[model samples]
Target: MKYIVCFSGGHSSALCAIECVRKVGKENVVLLNHNISEEVEDKDIKRFKQEIADYLGIKITYANMEGWEYKTPLRVCKELGGFKFGNGPALCTYNLKTKPFYKWLRDNFPIEKGSIRDDVRIIYGFDKNEPSRIQRRIGVMINQGYKCEFPLAFWDRTITCTEEIGIARPNTYKLFKHANCKGCLKSGKQQWYLTYCLYPELWEEAKQVENEIGYSIIKGSFLEELEPKFARMKCKGIVPTEKIKPQTFWAMVRKEIPDKSENLPCECAL
Candidate 1:
């Protein structure tokens, strides 16, 4: 059986790729990735992906969107017409990620007789805490005649390959929750605030995209409308680190800036 790992350049996915090699041997494992433009994706993420692929003795098979060789997220949103926020259908993700992935699949592994491909298993990096996501993914892949596995979901403990393999993780994990695009349009206010503070140029581009598209990346507030609030927090030295809860981070911010607003939501549109 060939184990094709959806090798997203995140810590969890990196571990999944390593564990897949350990289980089935490197010969039977394929590290499949979707390459985003460097302008959107961080350079450290690209480095980590290469390092992990090198460690596993396999080259990453990139599934790239044909026309979007170097399009940023904001550019994708602008050209795609509008950005969908918070659980709605996101055109950028579908066009940039999902469509290309399925195209690659069709080109490589054709479905025969409308049945699941028993000789191939697709691996995802969802952890044990995400039962609902796991089930949903299973449903989607099954419908498409693909079998799926979640190593992190079944493992007793987490497997982070960075320490054992001596490869430095992408720097995104140090500040952001996921190693997503630098200014991910699907992210919540917390991530946007962090982007505003760290990547002002990307933030400015996002604001411009919002203006061109005539809608906000966030549900109700344009980035321009939200910039002043983020500026205040930045002036007060408030920022987010990886995996910090929304309520807790906001409490710390309130201590410094004292906003009477209710706790902000940090759930991204994953």
Candidate 2:
């Protein structure tokens, strides 16, 4: 059976691809990479894609969203009205990622008339830790007449050797375990704070997008409104230089809050 694995050029998605290749073999698997406008300018993102492509030896199908363009949650909020709590960046996901993914699936692999082979399953690389996100993905797939599987979800539930090592070797310990867009609105203030310190250019770009759209991804606060507040709260957080290591940040976040698995309200971006 043919399987299409959605690739966001992030670690989670890469892990998902690796697992799929392990299960389905590389030939029957396709790496469907979405080329959202923001992502197009990211050199690190491009490198990630290349790394995955070289490692997998699978052709990456770069797909654009056609008429759809990158719009932050702030943009959507502005179009709808003023930004409010839980507005802006959240809505951006639906337009740029989820909706585009659905559209691509419809155009390339129709659901009706048994268009997809019966054995086909869409695999998402949501780690075992993110149950809410997995559930949401499953819900969306069901609505689209597809089945979803989460290999990492089960793995993430149990403590591992890696965790033991990470605990002992704190500096060696990687922070920030989850993977998605660098400035994804779903990411909390800490993550955004790290992004601001590490990739100031991208962070500034995100701010510009928010300003241009005249909304804030963080609902009640615009970037301009939130920046001063973020500046005031100072911590000896690791200042990322040059490259932002995704794995390191994931580990750091996980370390700070061991039981932070609760789902925030879906910002309707996805």
Candidate 3:
């Protein structure tokens, strides 16, 4: 009997929450947030989550990933393999987000993972502009046998009916182009360049982690190889056609920049 809205306080997610409130009333709409501490620093996501809740006058709950309180995407990259999601699901998305939130739902509501809970409808923040992203998520939900809804599916603008009251924007909105992870391992070389240019300390910390754990954050290229401009070209094609130690392989990777497309962030990065 709960209407969960994935509230990230971003343009699309925030608007979607407001729409949910309008449809189901504030009492039924619960703002479910997955707050990433942004690794190297605090992004102050709490402040924005509060703004969204206050503006909508809805119930807000912060979900946490058990045993992963200190784990960021960068920190998880060094565990076994490099920063590749592989052909299967990305562990970071499951560990950092989906697992904790769904566990909360099952504990409070009358629903389970595989069973279709007709009473519980999850509301997503996808807009009409991104049709493919919307459908992709819908397909995943269908396969999982979960009931979901997109309240903003037909909406096009960032400012919705609820934001008409003149609520202030979050300060962290200016930190990145998107309101996702700060130094996400899924980021491409161009994104890595932006991360280095915008937050060198975060970028440097990732490199230090890579060197310490003997695994690059990216699949083939290490963070140290994330060069600017022409450096992007050098970081690619580092894995030679021979077997070598992980540390030696990453060291060799730093000798050249990777192709811009090689490390592009996947949809789950958001």
Candidate 4:
């Protein structure tokens, strides 16, 4: 049996990798990463991933869409002339990350014919503080007949644990609450603004995508129109989210949250 941690080059996922490596032995643990090329090209996220791997001393592997000519979400949005957004995860979440990751899992770790053994365990990084998210994630994977677990939930480790481990967390965490794509479709005014100054090339692509779609990625203003409003503004460190009360198991089963595995255009695309 193999245990896979869906490493996202972020705090929670790194902690999960470390603890799981300690528990199951590094040979039994693999940090399975699925990435959007834009994340590496624009945000330079690969360096963070390398740091995590070196620090954790665990074997980390990646599953990426090498066959897809359009390697980035911005390109996909431009090709489609827009994307649908709602309460669900972003379109790229499936098209770029989860779908490929799932396909890799199925191909390499084929389900044995009529075998009942649970040969795989996938660990997601949702922290103990995010009980509702943890429950929702587990519920979705369970519904999909996956053997999933949340090590951070059990370990009760958060971002603080990353510091305790003597590794600096991903820079995206300092800029935003979550480590997502450089020009994520879900980004609001603030993130776009930061991208505009920090990564003009990616931001320009996003602007072009907005123009092609004839819709703002956010609610109202176009990226160009909104750029000046936040020009020269300092990056807001990890926006604080309002507390959603943790729910019971039954409540999670009953909750109508959208797909949890690809719930956000997050670092893990989960």
Candidate 5:
């Protein structure tokens, strides 16, 4: 049986890949990933992916959309004329990631469209802390006719597999909790503000996209509307780190900018 690990460029996924290789050997393991544009994805994420591939003696298999190479999330929003579909991830995620992956599986395997395959087992990187997410993923994968494995969820201890293999974690983790696109459209004000501070170009593009699509990334507040506020906070040197709680972060922002009593909501951009 082949073990197909969804090798997202993060610590948990990295550990999952390593453990999969250890169990079934590299030949039977596939490190499948979807490529996002460098403008959004950190360059170090690619480096870390390559490094992990080398460590496992396997090549990284990319399943990016055929004509969407180097396309940012904003580009997808512009082309699709929507940011998301009814409480799901941003359209770019479905177009750039989910679509291509399933296409690759169907094209390469004997599995027919909407059919199940017993030969391949899908793997995810959910850790034990995420029981809800893990259960949800399992249900989804099983419904799609694939068995799933989440090694990190059952592992005895947390492992920074990259460090064990003498590689540094992607620098994006220092700035954000996950190594997702810098301006992920699914994110809310907190993430967008962080993007405004750390990646102004992408933030500018997001603002432009919002204007074009007539939809705000944060439902009520457009990125353009929040720009001046974000700029003020940036000027005041008040950017929240990844670990800061939303309540605490907003409280501090309000304390600094006393004129605004509005608290921004946030979701994990990943």
Candidate 6:
């Protein structure tokens, strides 16, 4: 039985790839990444794919979901009259990532006629910190007749701090965090602010998408309406001397309150 590590080129999947390689050896493991033209840049995507392959010294396969057109959440919102504030970006996750991922799995490893063994596990990199996301991914894999393992689920600051203070940092954490598309609709305002300052081209692309779709994704207001307010706003708040790490930010947030169990599976989990 082959052990496949589905690589989304995200932080979670990157960590999964590393753990899978260490446990099963590189020869028996495969890293799988999908390419969708519209959602992410071709150059950035290729770099991510190559980086993983080089880091693990393993052969990685690139899969293109046939006729997979890149459709942003904004487009879906325009067609469906927009989801509630938190729910708007969820549609993009289902359509762009999850659906294509499952489709690829079925095509390559068919279930009918019992072609593949049921025990072959799929490794996902959902961290222990994200209970809701971890549960959703596990539930989906179980329904698909595959066991799911999460190696980085319980990884904490000790491991991260040790790595950072040491000679090297994990490829998963460094590359994947910055690898998210510059204008990811799912990102919060802080992320969007950084994107606006750092990568204007991608920000413009997002704006164009919103305009073409005739819908706003920011919720409660459109970018066209918000731009003026943003322009007029003064930078009164102190800028941090060092940028806060994503993991640190999540850790701090998690400490402020108990993690809530999601009553319903995220629509993206589908």
Q: What pairs collide in candidate 6?
A: 128-153
TM-score per candidate: 0.90, 0.65, 0.72, 0.74, 0.91, 0.67
Model 4, residue 108: C-alpha shift (Å): 2.4
lDDT of 6 by residue, 159-192 (tens): 3222232323333233235445445666654465
Q: Top model by lDDT, which number?
A: 1
- 175-239, model 3: which lDDT tens digit per residue? 45456676666555545655666677887778887787776656778776544332333334232
TM-score (C-alpha) between model 4 and the true structure = 0.74
All predictions: root-mean-square deviation over Cα?
5.3, 9.9, 10.0, 10.9, 4.9, 10.1
Residue 73 in candidate 4, Cα distance off native in Å: 1.7
**Comparing 1 and 6 on TM-score, the stronger one:** 1
Write candidate 2's Cα lDDT for 1-270 as tens digits. 767777776665667777677676998888888665554234556666666666778988866645445544434445555433453334556656666777877787788863433666777767767889988888867777788777567533332222232312112114344434556566656567756655676677768777766656665656665454344332324454313665765466456433333122222323
The runs of at least 3 residues in candidate 1 whose Cα sits more than 4 Å from the true structure, single-residue gaps closed, are: 85-88, 155-159, 240-243, 260-270
Which tens-of-lDDT digit does each residue in 179-202 have in candidate 4?
777767776655565577677888
For model 2, the superposed segments whose C-alpha errors exceed 4 Å read 38-41, 67-89, 113-117, 154-179, 198-214, 232-270
Q: Give lDDT: candidate 1, residue 188.
A: 87
For model 3, what is the alpha-carbon lDDT of residue 110? 48
How do all the candidates rank in terms of lDDT, highest first? Answer: 1, 5, 4, 3, 2, 6
Q: Candidate 2 versus the native: TM-score? A: 0.65
lDDT (10s digit) by residue, model 5, range 1-270 = 899999989877888898888888999999999988777788899899999999889999999886655677789879889898787877888898998888887777656557788889888988889999989988887776787888887755435557876988898887687888887777778888888887777888888888888888898998877876776777668864666877988888888776642333222211
Candidate 2 lDDT (Cα, 0 to 1): 0.59
Question: What local distance difference test score does each model get?
Answer: 0.82, 0.59, 0.64, 0.66, 0.81, 0.57
